[model samples]
Target chain A: MKTNFRTAVLTVLIGAGTVCSAVAQDATTILQKMDEVMYSQKDMTGKNKIILIDKAGKQEIREATIQQKGTDKRMFRFTAPASQAGIAFLSLPGDVMYMYLPAFGRERRIASSAKNQNFAGTDFSYEDMESVPFSQKYTPKLIKTETDAFVLELTPKVRSDFSKVTVSIHKEHFYPILMEYYDRGGNKVKEAKYTFKKIGNYWNPAEIEMTDLKKGHTTKMQMTDVKYDTGLSDDAFTVRALVQ
Target chain B: MKAKITVLLFSIFVAISGKISAQEENNIKLSGELLTDQRLLLRDNNDWAWNENRLTLKLDKQISSESKFYSEIWLRNIGLPNAVHSSSLYNKGIIDPYNLEIREAYLQINGFLNKKIDLTLGRQQIVWGTADKLNPTDNLNPYDLEDILDFGRKRGSDAINLQYYFNYDFSVQGVFIPFFQPANMPVGIFADLLNPSIAMPQGMVLNNFSDTLMMPKYNLGESSTVGLRFKGFAKGVDFSLSYVWGYDGLPYSSKNMLTPVNMNGETNIQSELSFMRNHIIGVDLATSIGGAGVWAEAAAFIPDQDMVMTTDLSALYPGSPEPVTQDSVLLKKNKPYIKFVIGGDYFFADGSYLNLQYLHGFVHERGSEGLNDYFFLRYEKTFFNEKLKITPIGGGFIVTDWGDINENYAIAYLPEISYKATPNAEITLSAAIFDGKGDHLFASLKDYNMLMLKMKYSF
Candidate 1:
């Protein structure tokens, strides 16, 4: 009777380990698929707008011509709201960034120390707009499987503003549906939600909303006229390009 | 010839506009700004206040895929004729203080030399420095000192700038300015002291008010003004090395000596202000570390000759005018000096930013302590979703070897609060306070303590 009991216990333990391994693999696969789908293009250009809503429901809008090259470079030139016109921002790899303000008539290099700070008075931080691939920056573990979404708890593999992030991914298209950012104390501080739509052979987030729980403010970035694989020049994503 | 030149330029503009209108992708943008300032002098309850209104109109035209044109004109000082001298229209039939000043009109072309070179021609502002306000490498344009109450404003330069890009991260640029523009200095009244426009005895109440200031014009060439810049980004750091063979923008002269003349029933002082060739070599670096932005800039100036100014103070202190109580003295010369600044800035979570800097100016020539050190601090806070920004900026200067009779230190503080009422409108309120004694920087401008309000509307 003792020998039979030991055999049963071992079989159950082995089966549980195998199940845990398979679950982890599934979480990674989901994250990889999401990254692959959004990062499939070499370059893209889009007309973007950021709408900032304050606590009192006052709204301010900024419009820009946003372009991206390769997977690591991004540039934006503000065109609306005369006060912010002719302002350009360029982001390169290694957290290198630059800003050209027409009022100053020169390009200023931006350091990486303020990555977690607000970007252009928006609720989104610079890190929130950073293009570091999710699969490259975080390690995911399957927390639960929903009826239509996969919940993955991510621990940053690199230095990040958030201690932990819980993300929800669409089951069919593998696009990120939601992300809740937690502080070091494990308190939810911010949440980002995305609504994806298929556009010209690719899935894109047509609407993105970022909410700051502490500040009680929300910022929405809506994408329009987005074209993928447009063959943007590498020079266009550089600091020198800000002059134009 | 002038009319012909104007017609030729007009033809070029019309041709470009025609081409752009024909293209489907061309865009023409029109925008402008009007800034109105109302200031009150704390010391002067009656006269000598800061009041000015400015209007700027800008045009941006995309001529083609590789060409663009931009232009701006400034209409300054709307309410009074005191500031009408800057307007050429005043010389014409327009008799109001509503003066017109062309700020920038530049055409930029790309895709030259197989897409490696670019050019910008006409009047434009070019800023070159890594530091904030305490920049040592920004010597491109002459300053607008006509309004002493307002500082840090500069006029654009007419030039042709050529740039050659290398690998998109580095570039070599050369600027050729065909002419020279000197800093503007206006005559002002001194209630209880000597007027700065003329080198007369302090506190001397002369029966006749007469002074002659002769200003010389300098032509541009290898001996006058030229700029060369090389900038590159490497290893997460951006750096630039530049040189300018230029003249002092603030019309200084080797013949600044004052001569109290008594000739042909005239008793006044004559001072000559001229420009000479000078060379400046500058280098700057900027990088990020941990979460703070660090930058430094340094420039070394070499002048063709030394400047000397004579001060005769004994005649004004209850002394005889002929056998002066003390002999006239010539101030020392600062032949060549170096100016440098290092600064860093950081942002806090509450959307507050802070910057601190240290600047060392080698001003004193023959002293153990030749350096004048200044510490600059600036703090800004964005409130109510960035609609309101409050900034407090100040500095402390420590002159190591101060003047024999002047104060050894000085301090200045300015706090400004600006509110963005709308996307195209802003209001700013600020105050300037200065304190020192006897030849210190703040002491010199102690009478300029003021409260200012400015409204800016943009479209």
Candidate 2:
């Protein structure tokens, strides 16, 4: 009777392993799909309102213009909040970044070693703004599967501020709506949730909220006038563009 | 002072209400700012001597796909108080301490060569250097140095600027100014140390031997200034090479004639300051390394003529009789010098930002050697979700030699605190504390230790 029970447990264990492997493979496919749909071959332009909520529940609103190309280059120019207007940020490949301030009337090339620093006093860090292809930066493993979404934990291949990131991908559209960043101890320190809207042929995030658990503050970004497939020239991404 | 503030407040209210009513009916976009600035003296009876009511209107409209118009008109009324003793003699409304002024106006067109070239014309400010806060190579706009401490206000020059982009990494920019406007020099008690005059006995007068008298004359049509800049990214750095043919922003002279007069038991002295034209070749570079932003700006100026500070008693004014003795005179040369600044900035995750920079005036000649160097730092941190920011700043030149620079070094501390009362309004409180040897730059301003507060609003 003991031998029969052991054989039956072995068969069930093998079946479960196969199912888990299948789900893990599906997770990889889903990540690839998200990357494919999330990026554009041409350029894109949009505007966003950055609402910063402090610990006291007070809100500070800032408006900005966002432009992105492929997966490597992006620029954000502050347009509202008179004090912050004309402040700009640009991130290019090679982990390079630049910032322009109206007060300085010039551009500053941000150093790579500073990548972990906060970006423009926001909850997001400089690395968070780097739009490198996720497939290039993180290795994912399917941790769980639900009826509507799949949970994947990603470990960065390079040195990163976060040891691991947990992401939730929607099953139907393969879009990432939730990302929780974890420290070495696996404690959740920060998380971001995105709301996606289908525009023409693309599914894009219309709103994003990132909350810092330790700081007790949250930053919510709402996109407006999002346009894709713009025929933006490469010159617009080069260093010469900062002067304007 | 209370009445003046009330008048300004009433005016701003009227202006804002008018704009709101007209904004919805007009297609042209309009925005403006109103500033109530006051600088209180910590050492004197003047509660806020540097008080002013400032307004700026920014307008933009798209003419077509290829062109647009942009302009910002700034008007400020600087109220008057009993002028500082050292500066009262020169104030004679030369800079118009209380008046209206237009700051900037420009039209932009992008119609040349498939939109690869663009032009900006009209009165504009062309800031040309990459250095943070302190740009040694920027010489295009004349400075409004009415308040030498207020370095942010740049008097725009009327110019036509053209830019041609050669691919993404390179561009050539040029500007032309038709007339020369010398930098505004504020002569006050603080100026005594830097430009103190030799004591004049009764019946003594000083004059310029040159044909021009008090002010240097420039032909409106012939005294045009030109500038060229080629800026782009190379290797891993953003660099620029610039050339400017212009006059010195500060008025300095080669010679002076002193005259003495005794009329009706009164003594008076008169003096004229001369200026020289100069050409500058500047190179500026900006790059990043090791988590800091690094920048450097250097300019080499070649004066058209050697500066000679001449005091000749033999040559008197046309109306006065020449001296019989032909007293001896003093002659000195203010040779050319090079100015450069190197700086770096680092920003931390917790909103702590620090920038350090050094500036120097280097010369080859021993007696005419300009100055040694020193560095400055501005450290800032934000708190309470950027609602509040505190900054501590200190910087000034380290002086050497008595001909121009005096005292070993000057140190200053300017701590500022600011609060964002609302999305459109802000209040700032700050103080300037200076210390140094008796002759250093900071020590000369020992009398002006100040606490300043300002409130600004934007629409």
Candidate 3:
């Protein structure tokens, strides 16, 4: 009777393990679907307006023109703020990046280690501004499931500023609605919320708000004149284009 | 002819602006900044080193989908506290201290003949190299030394630039400058201190001294400058190879004469200074290794001819000398010399930045033997969400001679603190201290230690 009871317990444990594996697989699939929905277009161009708010409620605004091709190439050119005008940032595949300052009249290579640093004094880090899809950088596991969404806990595959990130993805569309970022010490340090709108058969992010809890600062980016599948050539992402 | 060219460029700019204005899809941009910089020396009798207010205006207009016109202008009121001469005030109705400068005015046309070709004409700055401030390969434009503190600043040159792309990762650029422009030197007390003086013999005293500057003529082979560069990127590395045929911005003494005034030991000296022509071949590369950004730039300068300074001492000792004697010194040999800079920068996890560089030569230093080694470092940290930045350690160490560095070294320390009072306004406090024991560049600046305050606003 004791042997039979042990076997039954072993079977139940194995069954639970199988269920966990299935859930993890489901989570990865959902994450990939989210990435697919985010970057469904072949190319995209938009004008972005960023508003930064300090703890004391002071606000500063910046404007930029953003262009993206595929899921790897992206470029940002600042158009507003006289001091920052004509500054450009280009991100290409294999973690290559460059920054151009009009005053210098040349492009400077940005190291991969600078990914964690804030971009242009904004709350968004260089990693956050990257055009790479999340599925390529993080491994996800389903932590919980709600009536309207599935909560996923993601661990980075490579070195990163955040230890882990928790994302709440919509159940129907597989688009992320909110994300909470934790530091290496396992403390929640930042949060990001997204608003998506369907623009001619594509789910486009209309606005995104990122808040740094430790610094008591927030950055809100609003997208306008969004265009998708514009057939942008590869030449547009080159260093020559960046300086121009 | 230069005036005609300038007029033609402006006429083209005006015609393009008119054509673009008639189109409803034209886009025009206007931006600039206002700045006031004040510096004071820290000495027994404290004095103002620099007091100036400047206004900059930039205009950009899109003429077509593949063409654009851009211009920048600066208006400066320098030496605000200096008194105007009564004679000048009497001659002119109002003695305005403000001066206007056209910094850049260029017309850029993309896809000139094909999709891979581009052309830019008029006054512009053609910057090259991969290093930060100490780029040995960036010599197309003459240095702008109006403010010595503003290092790496360059004046715009009137040129025709053409770029052709072989592919997305590689391109070639050619630039032709019709005229040569000399470097602008600093004014005021610094100028007097930096002026070169003649070294006289022990027995002879200098009664009078005179000098003449000999500039190159306005001819294609004499005054014109040309440059070519081939740039490419591969495996996450950007590289460039460039060649420039031009004259050095600084002049060298070419001829000297010493004449005896009387039987006494008093003498008069006359000198002639001229610029040296050279050919520079440069190579530079920039890449990231193990998370840190690294760059290196090197230039090999080959002078066209040997620089010989002839001092005619025949008149100094007329009767006592057995034969007429003329002293000739070889200032610089017609050999190839190199200048290079290697640098790296990293950002720490705690929001600190560190940049370091090893430079083999300064701008004014030419010959291989005359070049001094320098190590530069800058470290800074930001506080209060990046509103305040403090650079506690920033400056360079000059080693005049590597063998005897203990006694032939100079150290300069620059500490700065800047605060962003508002989104568009900033205030900065900085100081430069120098100490040295030998004949390095910084040794001459030991007594010129200064404190500076700057206020800038952008609109």
Candidate 4:
């Protein structure tokens, strides 16, 4: 009819370009299946009750609890009111300890001098409370693959502390949707946006924004009654449950 | 003092008339400033044009919700004319016109319990250290380098303060100066050395307080003060600690004869003393890393309760005759006197931020018998984008550790330039290089070099 419809449209565009080049050449198994579907429905490893809100919208509700036991152990725990209950913020993979209160009852160990302060005076800072160990500090770069997302450009392979991280994953679910922070005069103060919603089989992020380019401030965290793998422990995230 | 100013204006007018019948809200603040200086120091010496003007008026009112009622009034050196006359007897008078009184008035209170306690009782200005020219243990207030070379004026105190906090780190403060008003009083060392016709006599009643300005030529006793402060911060480290106690020294002697018919004029001895007893103690520390930052401090003053004795009121006024004695042990040469500072700051890799410092002062023995042994060096930097700023301040007063004013040496070299223009306007250019030798040539005028230009507008 028209040369058999131009050879069946070039054989369905070469079979959708070999299935998108086999999922972009296995980029670390598509980023570990996007961190197991972004921690498949909670229980992503014990404890968390953070509330950091600042930019003059002042508010710091904390009851920390985190213990992530895979992808390199991490721990943090800070109880409440009675003056920073016990306080503990550790990271094991090249040191980072911040023990707590010791005007007497012992527990002192905060030195590396201010890891970049600002975690209660909020606006993140404390190196933005860990969680970015992207294979020894970034260097990621995938660039593109639209339709569901997957665009990375991390940089910063050694300054020993973030100077670049531009993630944006999704691609059928590996959730990350945004992260920008740069300052060493590289400008770009801060940014963190996420807004996934899928419920079962996970994609988390039901709302999270944290902008602050030189203080114009912004902070929004909405998760309203979430429940994922509810089974936290490890002495409820230690330091004696943040000083009991 | 008028019953401590009517018990501090009746506790701030009954806490602003009981917070206006309990609607609880009150605040009335007003700030003031008016300064001028024009000194073209002899380039061609046309009678050395000198200019100075000052005007300050401040008022603050905020009753209930933790009191506050303040005042600061001044109108000095306006277009000169206080019957001009100054060239030593000690030099300070000339602010005539009935003494235009009242320099500061105070009252303050804060969060009784909830907000973590605080209370201030009138006439205040207490600044503690971070060294900018050796603040020898920063004793409440005391600084008047001829009003910073004719009107860059800055000095404060009139105290009663109490503070306490249990959060935001930690704090504890206390300052009291029941009576210690010393600032341009008795006309700064009695017009620099008496002789207002020998302390008034020909139609006395000099200014208000008439009756010859309430005679009583010289007597500065009955003084009191107390202080305590503590501060804290965790994780990012920060610290401060202080202690002070008041009333030190008491002495007055004035006698003169400056040749009332060839009996010699160089013998007008005057002495008004207060030999230390205003306890003091201090400590400070700061820390930071990851861009670097550090600070340090130290203070001591206990001996005769901390010494700072200065003499030679024309040689000890009131009928002088050999009276500047001591074979040591004038209370063992009163001790204390120790001030120190160490600094650090760095953050340059194209972001600008470099602050280096070093300061020291240690001349116990009454600053080795009247002032000396103080050194300071400061450097500040920031360029372009930060809107240009450069500061190079250096200070001195080694004078071979005093002692007969040991070949006296007083040096100052300030070079500041600022240009903010916007962000509330700013234009500054400071130049100074005052070097006075030998007991600072009886207090300055030996190699003077001063130039200043400042314009600041902020809203």
Candidate 5:
């Protein structure tokens, strides 16, 4: 009778251990699922450009390389018009840093106050160029589920300059599909939409559109050609490259 | 001193009132440049070396949704306002002049008359033009050196304007300028006859070469003008036409001989006699086909019914006993009084574009003198990862038989390079070879080589 009781206790302990291990595996799977979609392509080295048109039909074009590291950070190198070479812009989660020109011999850092100003004397503002980490500032609620992507309605956790920002993330890839920004007055200031395609095991967007609501202007960016793993180094981001 | 104090007190009161009432309406915008030119101005040679370092600040505050106030403050030569000219001067030499002068100050009110009209009464810039250097068709506001020297862009005028926009496609504007500063002409010895301080050799020769002789000196005359402009998309084409009339303080003069002399003989003093009203008519057209865009413009100027002529040669030799008079000689001389331009730009695949332009000046028969013909050609290309872009330009003048540069040609070779060092910064290096007067107008260190560098931040 004693031997039979010990066997039952061992069986129960084994069953509990199996259940805990299964739960841990499930959590790991979920995290990987999110990360795989977010960072499917690491070090996506390529050239891309966008042209924006205003109501007056004036056009401005911007070109850069899309780079990545780990799961959150990405750097862009501006290589067009000798005037804007070696312009380095880095984004890491909620934080962003940008450095540009100060004549030929000097490199001046951009002040935070200048972010709201116009970009290159154009209608687009500096804040309109890149995205702020949505996970840090908002309580994102999954509003709807679609076959290919998910819609998220983000409400700011604190009183801030921007009232609300809506985002769409690809379901299978976890890549960003679209983002809509709302001004302080609850007016839709601008909307950016991304369209992605699969190329050799990598999911990247071939084109993106950013439209301004108040000004009736739109900027379209297209990645015509791309080269991955080009072995670009950190030294390429220096001011010396501006002239080289 | 007492008036200045009173004015200061009033300004303070206004400031306090604005601050107390409109705390949330303050909207300030800052825009300017930190620039240095390689052309340092020279004194006498046709070739000159000129350099400029400047910064400008603009501030605006809305008194209400309907009313707003704005001002533009400038700092020039960075620290040498006094060393440079005062039109928008910065500092003199060792000390920073610390100028708080107003480049533009104005009050604007909108949503008037049931929200159908907009009224702006103050100093404001009104711009309309298509071509770069040749903007003769853009007559909304006259262009001047003060506006050009300051930024190469035209500026605002002290006036009150009203515009009624029936919709996005149609609008009519009436501008009443109580006063306007005309473009400054070079102060020549002949041009300064009225100023007695610069005395020439005693008993300098004087000649009356124009028919009209009695006219006012200052060109800043009071005038009121009303214009009807129609801008709409008709058959997918954009077009506009304008008509204006006002008192022209600087009247055109016909060369007349006070004591008749032959055309070949030596001439003396020239006087500005008589003045007249001016009537202006202008039109503009623009259309796009496929991926290319084209535009054209025409303008005509009719001087006041009674006009006079002014001569510069008179001031040079103040002691000449008898001046020569030739009307046909004066009217058809250095430059044409009327001008026009037609231009177009075409966009190509892979971020490439081509621009073509043509300009012509109409013959002015002020007793019959006309300036030579002027034209330019420009071409630009981008390649090398788009990291390198080059613009090679060449153009010159072809004056008429009697025109100054008659058949005399001058050309310019410009190569502009743009290097994108990173995603956020850019550096532009521009070099060009320009041959011309290289004087006050577009003077460089030489009538030859010019180099410019620009660093931009696109954040």
Candidate 6:
């Protein structure tokens, strides 16, 4: 009787393990699908309007032109707020980044370790501006499922400022609606909310708001004149083009 | 002639602006800034050092898919004019301390001959090197020291720059400047004190002193400058090798004369100053290691001739029974001397930055023996969502003679705070403090401690 009981318990435990494994696989698949949905375009160009709101409700606006090729190359050139005009940032594969200041008339290489620093006084960090896919940078596990969304906890595959990130993804479209970022000490530090609009065949992020929990600051980025698959050449993503 | 040139340039800009406004394509873009900078001396008797108001305008237009034009102009009122004679401003209309400057006006053509060639014509700033403000390889333009506080500023040069690209990661650039322009020295009391002093014998006192600056002739082979650079990126590092054949922007004392002593036991001295010719070979590299950005730049200057000052002292000793004697001092040997800078910068998680550099020579320092070692450091932190920044520590330490550091060392401190009043405006308050016991560069500036306030708005 004891042997039979032990066998039955073992079978039940094995069955639970299999279910957990399947759930994990499902979470990864969902994350990949979400990445594909966001980065499926061959290239994209748009004008970005960024508004910074302080704790006292003071707002400052800045504008830039953003261009991206594939999922690993992106460029941002400031066009508004005359003080910051002609400042540019280029991000390439393998965590490489370069910054150009018009006053200096030269491009400077930004270190990978500085990824956690704020980008141009905005709430978004350099890591947040990278054109990398979420599925490639993070490993996701299903935490729970709501009525219309799936909650997943993502742990970084490499060294990162955040210990983990929790994202709420749409059930039908696989697009992320909200994300909460936690610091290395496991404290929630930032929150980002996204609003996506279907542009032709692709789901484009029309607007995004990132809030710094510690600083009591929020940055709102609104995209305008968004164009996808415009056939931007690889030359546009190089350092030579960055200075221009 | 000067007024004619100014009017002509102004008319050209006005015509261009009018044409651009009439065009419907909207290809031309305009931007500008207005700034007011005031400074006060922090000495026994506090006095105003500078009260400057400036307006700058920039215009950019796309002429074609592969060509573009750009121009920048500055209109400034820097206190009262220095002219003491009414005749100096006779024909110059509305000369109320106003000056017009054409900072840059250039046309760029890409894919000139092939897909790899590009050319830029007219006046432009050709900045070189990977370091920040202190670049040893940046010599194409003359130094603009009109405002001593604005260090490392340079005047634009009229040149033709051609670049040929071997690939996306590599390129070669050549620049030819048709004329030489001398650096603008500081005005007012600083200029007076910076003049070289002559030492005389006990019995002979200085009665009169005169000096003349001899500029090179306008011939192409004598006064023109040329430069070449090869730039490339490899293994996550950007590097460049450059060469410049030019004349030094600063003049040196080349000849001197001591007049015969009069009955009052006084003598007169005359000096001639001229620019020195040099060939500079430079190399610069920029890369990142871990979390820090690192850069290094070095330039080897090879002078065409030995720098010697010949002083004819025969007249001073009229009763001497010997042949006419002359004194010769070798200021610099005809050999290669190097200037280099190595630096690194890092950003911390708390929104603070630290930059450090070790410089082997200052801008005015020349020759191996005259060069001094310096270490520059800057630390800044931002608050209030980066709207306000405080640079608590920003300065340089000069070691004039490493062997006698205790007596030959100097220190300068620049503490500053700036606030972004708006997205397009900023207000800054800063102070410059200097102290030293030796005869280093900072020692001369010790008495010029100052407090500065600057307000700038851009549109």
lDDT per prediction?
A: 0.75, 0.73, 0.87, 0.51, 0.51, 0.87
> Which structure among the candidates has the greatest TM-score?
3
Better of 3 and 6 by DockQ: 6
Instruction: List candidate 2 segments past 4 Å from native.
Output: A1-30, A102-115, A184-186, A238-244, B1-27, B44-47, B81-97, B187-222, B260-269, B315-336, B362-368, B393-397, B401-407
lDDT of 6 at A82: 93
Tens-digit lDDT string for candidate 6 (A116-172): 689889999888887688998999999989998999999999888899999999999
Q: How many backbone clashes does candidate 4 have?
A: 28
Instruction: List model 3 lDDT by residue over B352-450, tens digit each.
Output: 888999999988787888889989999999876677899999999999988988989989999999998876788999999999878666777788899
Candidate 2 per-residue C-alpha lDDT over B20-65 given as tens digits, one digit per residue, 9 for 90 to 100? 3432332466777899877877874865557677888878775554
- Candidate 1 chain A: worst-modelled 10 consecutive residues by lDDT: A108-117
lDDT of 1 by residue, B1-459 (tens): 999999988975675455445444557888999899887777747454555688889988887877788999988864444434667455533444556888899987775434787778889887887987556777777766565544456788998888888887798989888777776653233222223344334533333443344444444433346899999988988999999877666543223322233433333333445555567789999999887899999987766554444333333333455533232222223555678889898877678888888888622121123456777788899987788999976545555444542555666777899999998899999987776665544566676777878999988
Query: DockQ (Cα-based) per candidate?
Result: 0.75, 0.43, 0.67, 0.03, 0.03, 0.71
The runs of at least 3 residues in candidate 5 whose Cα sits more than 4 Å from the true structure, single-residue gaps closed, are A1-244, B1-24, B40-48, B62-67, B78-103, B146-152, B185-228, B246-277, B310-338, B362-372, B382-389, B394-406, B418-428, B436-448, B454-459
Two-chain complex of model 2, DockQ on C-alpha atoms against the true structure: 0.43
Clashing pairs in 3: none
Return the number of clashes found in candidate 3.
0
Residues A1-244, model 5: lDDT tens digits: 8999999999989998887676555433433444465354545566768676767776667776666544445566665533354456554333223344322212222333334444443334555544333454466656666787666666778665568877777766776688888888898887888887777776666777777676687777778676544665543332222211
Which ten residues in a row are the worst by lDDT in model 5 chain B?
B186-195
Clashing pairs in 1: A113-B291
TM-score of each: 0.85, 0.82, 0.94, 0.30, 0.51, 0.93
Candidate 5 lDDT by residue in tens digits, B35-131 = 3443422235533333444455556666665556777766655323234356444433534433343556777655444354656667765443344
Tell me the spans in candidate 3 whose CA falls farther than 4 Å from its real position.
Answer: A1-3, B1-25, B80-85, B88-96, B262-264, B318-334
Candidate 4 interface RMSD, angstroms, 1 decimal: 17.6
How do the residues A163-204 of candidate 3 rate in per-residue lDDT, one tens digit apiece? 999999999988889999999999999999999998998999
What class would a CAPRI assessor give candidate 4's docking? incorrect
| Cand. 5 TM to true fold | 0.51
B169-219 per-residue lDDT for model 6 (tens digits):
899999999999998887644564345557886788898888899999999
